[model samples]
Target: MTRVNHQHSKGPHEMPATGGDRPRTDHGHSHHAPPRSVEDHLRAVTELLGRSPWFGREPVRLPLEQAAGRVLAEDVEAGLDLPPFTNSQMDGYAVRSADTAVPSGLQNQHEQVDATAGNPGAADSTESLTSLRVGPTVPAGHAPDPIEAGQAVPVMTGATLPPGADCVVPVEDARPSGFHAQGATVSVPAGQAPGRFVRPAGDDVVRGTRVLRAGDRLTPLALGTCAALGLGDVLVRPPLRVGILTTGDEVVQPGTPRGPAQIFDSNATILRGVLADAGAEVVAVHHVPDDDDVLRALLAPEAAEAPHPDLWISSGGISEGAFEVVRRVLSGPDVAEFSEFLHVAMQPGGPQGLARVDGVPFVCFPGNPISTWVSWEMFLRPALTAVTGAPSTRTEVRVRSGDEFECLPGRARVVRAHWDGEVLTKVGGYGSHLLAAAVGVNALVILPPGRGTVPSGQDVVVRLLT
Candidate 1:
């Protein structure tokens, strides 16, 4: 197990004290408090979002085409058996197993027995191969007629088996490998077992079987299964409606003119993609300068349009800085219901805040591009999984480290890495600002606090992003 260093931090399950417990600095920012463990902040976010109205809203019926990535609100049962009836699994001759049986002494004989050639007991002869008179052909979708004793019915793949037939001899195994006309004789091997090359009814899925359970995401393949079960639409949990706020005076939208000291805002793009991947619907997005008043007005209830978000997520302006617009506005007694600003014991995403703004839950993250991405992956995505069982939950695996890396003593080190199945290789530098270097990274390698330096080939825990 990969452990997070939490020696000086509180347990992840413990909620931080709100309001008066936080001492305010002269700049209106909360005084630095002991950093909380990564798990601690995650639990808080998960609990808050889980209780929101959007998470518990009634399920909506959506066509399979529109239900991709949505979680099922209820179990899906099959209306009918897959294949629906006993059928032939190959193009062959269907016959009674007893008619193909040969005496033990003749089992190894390579000779053929012609039952219509004056040999009254040819079917039971030890000196000859079993042969049967051919009946009418059975094409797919056609109701086949029953066969009599010493008779063979040609069947196409997926064709329903005739009532009197107990087994099929594939065309390749018949002495004459092609279909025969009515009343023709076809020679087959003896001692063929019943049910050979035959597909029993309900072989794939039985009627009334629970094929999909609640919380199962409607992926392409999953939707195909639903279609096979005769379902045109499914009941799915409503997507989480989210509002995003990106703050900073130095951040400008991409494709707009940029000042010498300002950079393009990547946080918005990053958040939008990840939120969508997590099955959330982005209801609103705004980039606010480091002005508390402007931030306050944007968050005001009446200012937001319909389909308002059930939660608001702001990036930047939550760290300990002089002009932290989000922290300043959301922390004010008049605008906030309950709020806590604290640090989590994880690099690149340590600064974190949880609050309620205008009765809607708010989660605040740090501003750096990589920091924002890491924050979503480490905190918000996991919280969403906990709340709605969304399919965005990442799969974690333990693998050998392909590269050696240093770790801080009291905070977990989250390194961008590429997992090539056999080993996890570091992708970029540990600095949160090295966003460009993070390209091609598919996993996050987490090293617990106090481990210091990990040697190559050592086992480490990794969360797959792809």
Candidate 2:
């Protein structure tokens, strides 16, 4: 129900169409409708979205390194506390918290395989460090000679605790030469927290703790947590693949310009980049002349991919034009028909909306340079949240309109705009053909139809692009 205030600017989706909403195909004619508006189109899509289902997939194990941008497939429970052992926090000394002072490496020579996961039938096979010699100056991995009673040993960072040692004193706390050859020991103040300076086995994440859950995105921090737990692989959901179809007779590949009316195809390329940035893989983009049969054949590639894209997006064609995809798809009586006309009431993108043909989801955006771009930002972007596991829309901010705006009287207006840190200024004259303006602009300001112009300096909400 939001309105655009700009009255002069128009986008391609404000296309003119007859009763059928199909235009002249052979002639490559455009359409224009007097009744529909951008607001109306947005409403229609919103209705369709409410009925759409979320993405679906099963989990599979992937290396933590490769899990970025993937959704967690299942809940991950910790196999053990992070360090899995009583270990030193510093390179200095280990002492019994109660003893106030102790010998270092009293049990440094002891090395044991972790058998915490017990084999009940073979308890004796479970290796545990019961006794070891106290060591002085023992490196972290090597074992020291057994400590005689009341003896201290040298230890280093990551060294195992000697038997009966409960705390570690940082080297700074004890003089380096103060020890009698036992890797230096120092006194502790009374009541230092037990397990102080020690990362308790499973303290970061305890054994059997649910560390991650299904639906969680594999972010950098999340990967770091998994790595700390010694995980090399993780289970995550499959990436969403998308099919991009660019349809039109006037469009030709870049560097192959023909007549003045023949423009290079920027929509497909732009759409591809946007789709990828949104986390949906562009499985393929099929370029087709305005023909129904040709499009169906082109969609074959999209269908061939292991998991078909949840959504199919086509740029251009949905008006009451002969070349419109919506019209051609709905032409057949063999179960694939778009029951609704291009009936959105919004301007510039009024002709754009969703359709169901043979149960495949499709959204159509206008072909005009700016219309195509605007349509995606307005309709498809929000709907993509489910497909990509990201938010439905990009970030938006409120800024002062640099000039009073006049838009179509009844339809909502979307104006490509530029936003500096302090203000949002309108871009080049609002026309679908103004590609240069669209390029310079970082956002589009929505002006609800029927609303009066907002004077310069008035606050307006602007959706960011790029």
Candidate 3:
């Protein structure tokens, strides 16, 4: 396996010089210092993740269509203006504003029948000639001849406006109606101002303007802007590669026959979805038995083989149990340096461990389904976002508990709860394995240590889970 460029950093379990003054409770007895705070452990994990090579590496070119939902690696400037040329905003008559500057209510009552053809019966009226004769139509995609001084051009919507035309009168406003079969005459509205209903070049966006900046996520709208700016491809960062391993002989695959103590493995499914939601590309997923030998053989590096994943996220076998396969194997000389494996002053997810196995970062969590889920949200989610610059999945909101709630004396409570826009209500009992209580919970109520019971209507800090 290709070894990651490992960095030496202090583990979360290492106590600071000031920690010696704090008291630690062991087996109902107060000792020298308390367990590490949640923020302290989170800081250490973030530090480790920041040293990863794939967190924020060099950029790679990708097609614009495939760059959606990924971070842009460089600023993209527009090559041409949005409109590229002046165009008509409506399918109507394009006229010079000076020709339509007549006052409102000026009527054109004189009728004409080709005076140039020598018809004296048709009287020639000067001031009564308020209507201008419509010129040739300017169809879309076909250039039109330049408009004359006293003439109006019939231009369709999105058609290029002929030179010397300053405004467009919608087809509905024309006296003779829209483009006609025979030659048409259009009435000019009074007080028609310049630039009215005319989409000028470079109005929406100018050429060479910075349209999209580096580190911006290529959302659907952002990608559309890139396409509009004449870009077919963009530079983006690749997704993080991760390997998931779920342990426990008692946990069998779904749809398989189970013995008396075996149950369907839900951790794998839950963690797979969780890692994907965190923007990690899960390259490999395996269900290893409680045997240490089988686990070691599958992970050992082979000659001329490809590198392992950038990171390994394992669930179960890290807790302090008799048959902890992961702990038994990684603690040996051949595999890794097991750094931290202690209670984290939090409920539902108290057991946690961090190690570097075969130069690949490994983060082990408790076996319980609820604990594994909570640990990811509480710790791994923030760490990944900080290192990889992924979007944040958390939000803090103040909420009032619906009923009286009690918390553990020394451990902080991260209870699954529901927030219905008004008040937050606690879910089922506080067992670490109570997976049923986690359903439909949009928030996690965080209660600090040393609190017995909180009365109803008290405001509590909660992390949004949606």
Candidate 4:
């Protein structure tokens, strides 16, 4: 077991780990007092870890080259109108209302109104006209002059409306292109509105409007919207630098096996992945012996400089074992009690906690792989997003379970699962050591802490995994 050695006493201004040593069995379980409820313990640590208050956040103007996963810093507005001008809603002929012989011309308002039951265009078709031939074609971008009284212009869908002409008569409504079709007369239909088939400028989004508001997450759809509006870059918050530590005398790395007393270090890799997914750039992942002197030496300023860590995360050494980090932190004459780690009422990942020592946020999680994962997803995720100004939310999606599963009562079980559209199928065995099952799982089916067993076809809220 490790213990902190202090040379001299410091004033109250100094900050140190809290708690005295509590005896533990050789295997490392604790003999301390029964732990408080997980929620209560979490709340206690948060209140103590004001080291979080020392952190600073800055805004950045990122070119498209570095914008992925960054939190947006400001509002983005449309620089110009979408589409830019009034256009055709479909491919058809743009004809003068007066040129066509049902609606009366607006010049004779009274007669026009009388041509039909109070409708406007009734007299134009009935006003009596001979024949009008097709004029020039109007494509999408440019506009042509108004339709003259004796002609019609062919217009493609999305073409800006000419100086005149409103409703479009679909191409099918007109005779086809050859002599058998073109030049043939078709009966006139009565009562077409003036602006019928025209799409007005700024119809989709008007210029100078706030297209995206401040703090909005830049999704692919949102990013596309900005690009369509002509923006090549976005303003967002810079990524945070985090310091990670994995603590355990028995922990080992992957691809290596130890005799009887060792297991691989899954916490470090799991946390790296989690932190990256949460948008943090790890400054250093400290792997130190489970000795307080070694940990303190590794944590000293000389080990890392320049851009200091904005936050730190460590696994294990927090329980009541003689070598418990929490105990060593609190026991030294240089150390001061700040908070305690709690065993929450949750399955597989119960021994999780967060603390603040000396102005740096420290998230202490269990050494067990599944325990660390659950702690990260349940607690640190929301907290990190909030601190970094990310517009991320822990989205809950409804899905049916494909199979029946049972879990410990009074403990929330975070089961791994695959979302197959309509239902979520539980992944391999619900053991904390099941890394394979947790790695590729796309969703987490959370059984309410202590909630009952879920049978097939039952509704469950799945936490999406990215």
lDDT to native, each model: 0.81, 0.60, 0.73, 0.64
The local distance difference test score of model 2 is 0.60
Model 4 TM: 0.74
Question: Can you tell me which runs of candidate 3 are displaced by over 4 Å?
Answer: 1-33, 55-58, 87-95, 102-162, 166-183, 187-189, 197-199, 303-307, 392-412, 415-439, 442-466
| Model 1 CA lDDT for position 125 | 44
lDDT of 3 by residue, 194-284 (tens): 9989999999899999988887778789899988887889988777777888886677888889777677778888888887776577888
For each candidate, give its TM-score against the true structure. 0.87, 0.64, 0.74, 0.74
Regarding TM-score, does 2 or 4 come out ahead? 4
TM-score-wise, the better of 1 and 2 is 1
Q: Which ten residues in a row have the lowest lDDT in candidate 3?
A: 3-12
lDDT of 1 at 172: 69
RMSD of 3: 10.5
Against the true structure, candidate 3 has what lDDT? 0.73
lDDT value, residue 217 of candidate 4: 72
Candidate 1 residue-wise lDDT, 1-466, digit = tens: 6421110111235332322223333222245667788887889899878667685567899998899999999999999998788999999999999997877676656565544455454465433457889999999999987889999899999999999898988986676668999899888877889999999989999998999999888888889999988899999999989989897767788889987767778888888998888889999999987666677678776787478788888888776656666776777677887787888889979888888765678988888878888998998899888888785668999898979989887898889999988868899788787777888999999889876699998998899988
Where in model 4 is the C-alpha error above 4 Å? Answer: 1-55, 89-101, 104-132, 139-158, 167-174, 177-197, 249-264, 320-337, 397-400, 449-452
Residue-level lDDT for 133 in candidate 4: 69
Candidate 1: where is the Cα deviation over 4 Å? 1-30, 106-129
The superposed Cα distance between candidate 2 and the true structure at residue 217, in angstroms, equals: 2.3
The predicted structure with the larger lDDT, 2 or 3, is: 3
